[model samples]
Target: MLKMFISGSIANNTIPDEVIKSVDVSMDKNYVILVGDAKGVDKNIQDLLKINNYSNVNIYHIGNKPRNLADKNWKQFKVIIDESNPKLFKDGKFTRSAQMIKDKRMVSEADFGLVIWQDVSTNRFGNVQVSKGSLNNIYNLLKMGKPVGLYFVPKPDEGIIKLTDLTYFENGVISNMVNVKTKQYYYEMKSEYEKVETQKKHDKKSQGEQLKFF
Candidate 1:
């Protein structure tokens, strides 16, 4: 069984549905964990999960008042809080700082971490700042030998950009790729190379075409 924890700026909605779809198709059984915040409980993710038959998904909303607790979408799993964090509940909702803290805690508890965020120079509501905090937590997880997968969705795009564009680790250094288009091209070429190699191993060519490579 493979356990994955999801944390990101909920407003982005970049990776949740795509992550879940990937997990469903993978060889391992998945336990999808979500750190719920005010913006995390969107209809897109809920409907996608229900339609895809994700029976092993679990969500942990770190708020005290619990706004979407009784919703049918959440009825599939058990929702719990850390219980030790007393500052989470305030003014009938969870504070932004508390939500970020909870996101870190959830990242620490999983086997692997997945983050979805955007790269914007200016954040109007300051919510995008949480992505940096979440990325820092993910960097720590990578230090502990955990594989942290990151996906970024650029503004005005509906699909998830490649993970390699937003994540990398080398020579004890971690960084995010700044050029999205270039990173995507790198991955695409790499994949094509792998496919050619696999085909070559099983291909038996005729004598006339022996000098030519596929």
Candidate 2:
């Protein structure tokens, strides 16, 4: 069975109509859904599933229990944390690493992913002008050569722009939609991806050159 990972910015509390429609199609196909237990999109999606009485869902969390599991009968996949692990704690909080671990697990297990992102403002990185968690979700999915369906929510109450499905190509550029509304921010993210890919290529070339000297 196909597994679909659904994630979104915690800033949005309601799911858009198009996103819900896509979820409906997934349900019709009896796909196993992998969702988080965060507020905003996660909680809203759970509510939708609960209303539809859908049970083919797995709620992923960080600790022994989920923060928000709408369906008690649904399955749970908890990523147990080690408080003693220094990497798991940032600024005296485990929230960032815990969520990353959970999201990574979801991305690894899913065949494809759908991300609902809100473009409010740029983060410290100034690469993607969206929620960090949602941006990471998209990047992780793409880097793993998994397809992603992105719903870009623009600021000032603009409607959602459903970007074409994207799959990373080794020698090709990152794929993105061309809209005057989102073009600038999209290219900003694309530039960052290019930098990473370039670094990887340079590192490999350096390794090969060293082998020649050996």
Candidate 3:
């Protein structure tokens, strides 16, 4: 079964028709989804599942209470604060570390990520542009050798979703098993499969240098 983590832009609440159809297909295939209790795409995802009566869903929340308590029947996992980062209280105000902790946990266990994103950032980080919080999970999945299906939210309220990588969904990636990891690795890679190749070359070069030193 495909286990997907759904995330999206916090700025947009719109849902495209293509996204709805993809969720339909995922539900039909008995996919289990993990979503946060935040607004934006998370809320949209909850709407889709609840309206369709898809019971195989889990909602992740931060702190003692969830930000959105729309689905009471949905099982929720409260994220424990990470002591290393230490974001419990700042100036008597709650920080967003709780959500980040939950996001990390979600990325660690998810088989694949289905996200709605729009590249609104003009500043480029090397080859890639800065992305939304949803892309954080997507990048983590890719770094861990997991696949992701991205639906880019269009401008001007066009009700369509487009995949950044056409060959991603075509490949049989959802059938793979998910690895259990305690931490998530968020790094810049070449591309989906290109990153694998790049990593292989880097490892080989490192091994060669080590042999010469020995």
Q: For each predicted model, how many residue pairs clash, with residues at least 3 apart or on different chains?
A: 0, 0, 0
Query: Model 2: per-residue lDDT, tens digit, 1-214?
Result: 9999999988788888888988999999999999999999999999999999999999999866898999899999888878788888666667676788889999999998988877454456775443667766777787777887777665323343333334332122223322333445555766887899999999999999999986
User: Candidate 1: RMSD over Cα atoms?
Assistant: 15.9
Find the candidate with the highest lDDT and give its number.
Answer: 2
Number of residue pairs clashing in candidate 3, backbone atoms closer than 3 angstroms, sequence gap of 3 or more or interchain: 0
Question: Can you write out model 1's per-residue Cα lDDT over 1-214, one digit (the tens) per residue?
Answer: 5666655554554345666665465324556544443454233444455566555555555444434432445423223444455576565655555655655566666777665655333468553232444445455566556776655554324344333222344211222433443335444644665688777765745533775764
lDDT computed for candidate 1: 0.50
- What is the lDDT, from 0 to 100, of the residue 71 in candidate 2? 88
Query: How far off is residue 167 in model 1, in Å?
Result: 10
**TM-score against native, each model:** 0.54, 0.71, 0.65
Best by TM-score: 2
Error of 3 at 184 (Å): 21
lDDT of every model, 2 decimals: 0.50, 0.77, 0.66
Better of 2 and 3 by lDDT: 2
RMSD of each: 15.9, 5.8, 9.5
Give residue 102's error in model 3 in angstroms: 1.1
